[model samples]
Target: MIEPELTRCVASFHPGATGVTGAAKLSGGASQETWTFDIVHPSGNVGAILRRAPPGYGAAPGRAAGLDAEATLMQLAHDAGLPSPKVMHVLTPEDGLGRGFIMARVEGETIARKILRDEEFAKARPMLARQLGRVIAGIHGLPQAKLPQLRSLTATKEIEDLAREYQSFNWPRPVFELALRWLRDHDPGPSSEVTLVHGDFRHGNLIIGPDGVRAVLDWELAHTGDPMEDIGWICVNSWRFGEIDKPVGGFGTREDLFAGYAEAGRKVDPDRVMFWEVMGTLRWGVMCCGMMQRFRLGPDHSMERAMIGRRASETEIDLLRLLAPRGK
Candidate 1:
């Protein structure tokens, strides 16, 4: 059942509304509930999406206030001229939808599986790579002054703390444990240049259209930290979309991506990218375990969640192979 507060807020947002009808949930979201709605206002009809926190999920320890902050970050990113959803309205937990935001629904294909297989984007792969570099550069270039509300959210943690936090999750997966160790041993000297890091930046999170990447969705994991974090994340093997040979979201080689960056006047560092790729794998592996833990938290009906836990093995194996080749 749709809560009255959500209905009221939706109506209020669209003044002179005559009727509002909600559609089904959008696939691929696990942390929260998302639904599309149809509105019949005096002016015209428009479609909207409503996202809300699930019961008992946010109450868990170590789970930060995500949805509300994500909305703010997305808006800020959009305002900064980064290609993202135009912010509409943000509802607090006090507002009764638990926590959520409504934004302009832009059109593009977001499903990773489809984007990889779709023939239309195959021809524009090179252009996509260049475009991706530009957008990433812009996101990394956001000024700290404009994002004051994110101070507590962007607090940097020591590498030791990050390492300990993942280890404490008690992931039973062997590969995940090994990746954690690799990260600890390879810890780059604590970098304090806190820039905006898109916690998860890969092919799947981006939407492609005839024009270019229409929108960059899913800011739930956005943070303030190393710029290389996003760079490494985009090149992670798991995000290669079943095309292991070609890196950078399976669109082009690392060289191609570096060219795009160089064209944008951003210095290229192969070693930094390699380091972040390792970190990206370890971070994802740990997150997979966290999702598995949710089974014990509440309803764990999602086969996708179970599969994500299983995916830790692939990440671990990839990390190990990268750190230590079979025959040196």
Candidate 2:
């Protein structure tokens, strides 16, 4: 239960918290816990969400820099002319809710499976892909020097440092080892160019509406890095949801998305994006290994962790197929 003082603190921040009630936990978030609440004011009622990072398997260090920076990055994205919810406030550790923030509950379609299967958004798929490209381009164009908060949170000097960090991890999968070597060797040339990357941007990460995209949600992984990381992360096959042919966020082709990005003043490099996608598969595979790392020895066994262990093989297979062409 939330303390009365903390509740009052939340209420004080927004005038809409007069009779805040029905606060319940939301589902589907594996890393952090999210709660949705109904706030009743004298004028009307409003819906809002709060995200908190609890002690978990994948929690990163840097308290203030974690979710707090996400809030600021979301604000920056909104300022950069992308569709995003308005960030109301960021809470400190003392706030009793753990590391988190409050934001307007954006109403739109965010589920990839639902969007792809639903008849309502059939025609809107292409437009959604185009808008996604444009939004990504906008994020990549942000002034690097202006984003000191993000720079402080990052562990690497460059985006490629992520690959190095991954290499250092004690991984159980051989595919990941091969991928790390490939990434290090390729090196994408040194990029002095840095920009804001929505660490996990994809179909489900975006909220699509009839008019257009309403909000870009989930800034937990926001960071400073090469723009192609964001591009490749989206194109990762895991997000494609079995649709191998449909590359543009599980809807349109990469060609259409690239054209859209080009129109948005961002140059699209197929090879660069492909590299990141490979990294995405490999990195996520490593992450799954980390999830099950505790159980590797024995005694702390979990069925979920074992299931995740099976996922690495498929990702490795995908990476191999992507790199090894017909004649290569």
Candidate 3:
């Protein structure tokens, strides 16, 4: 059924003469879906992925960057010689698949635990921090005028947003309250330079192979903001997934990350990165609570939400370690 539509879609964009096969849903929810398939052609089978809203969801809710913007960002990164998928086609109504785009698939592993412990990625683990640092710099350096309209965020606005979202849950998390007060009292006001911030940059969003980061995926949370925000978010403890000692995604240190960023001719303010790290920690905690609310009250009743929601307490431990560090 969908193959017929996909066949037509690919034929228009790619000079292929045949159809599609092996179309299967990889992951999805109510708002978005990712499907993997092979475009059958006389040359061979070309692996492709479709990220769409399934013909019904009009736009991304809350703070998500719309799919159109995601496609554009990907194309820009690809053009800039950064690690990103090559966008193959942008869907139209006539394509009949929904609102989304097709992109060439990059092969890699996204699981954090496996990337941390597995021998296959052993060589990649150490170099990832620095390599990804350069990648982040490239992302921040993307030409602004060519970019699609995105929400610009500041540290104050981010704190307020997180605070409001947390208070709505009516959950009395003392650690969260402490973090909120600290962020307010030490508010750094506006940043000196605003650039594209990959709002969610972590293990799961990166495609890693033995060589290093093959491609950066999931620009759904991409936005224009303090460039330091991206560095801070990547350093959060929850993303480390147990390798707390290695702060940068459980593989490397802040020093290396900064070094890599500096290699790109960009200066970094260590103090700002530190502040955003704390903010990012508390933000993830609030999001965990939101997951609980969505699971209990929202339409989706999947157990994954409940599982991730239970990890909120771990973030409290991390917050304490960050804000009130003990002499070691």
**lDDT (Cα) of model 1:** 0.69
Candidate 2: regions farther than 4 A off: 3-7, 27-31, 54-65, 92-95, 151-174, 210-212, 294-302, 326-328
Q: How many clashes does the backbone of model 1 have?
A: 0
TM-score each candidate: 0.84, 0.84, 0.98
Model 1 vs. true fold: TM: 0.84
Q: Which candidate would rank higher by TM-score, 1 or 3?
A: 3
Residues 286-305 of candidate 3: C-alpha lDDT, one tens digit per residue: 99999999999999887999
Highest TM-score, which number? 3
lDDT of 2 by residue, 101-153 (tens): 87878887888887877788877876877777887888788767666365422
Clashes of 3: 0
Per-residue alpha-carbon lDDT of model 1 for 1-328, expressed as tens digits? Answer: 6635556776767677666676567752446777777666778767777766754456312434377777877787798888888777887555566666877677778777667777877766767777787778777777776653442222124345556666766645566566667666766654456677776778667878856688887776666767667777788888877888878887767777777766766765677678788877777767677677665564775777777767767777787878776985
Off by over 4 Å in 1: 3-7, 27-31, 54-65, 92-95, 151-162, 169-178, 262-265, 296-298
Steric collisions counted per model: 0, 0, 0
In the predicted model 2, the residue pairs found to clash are none
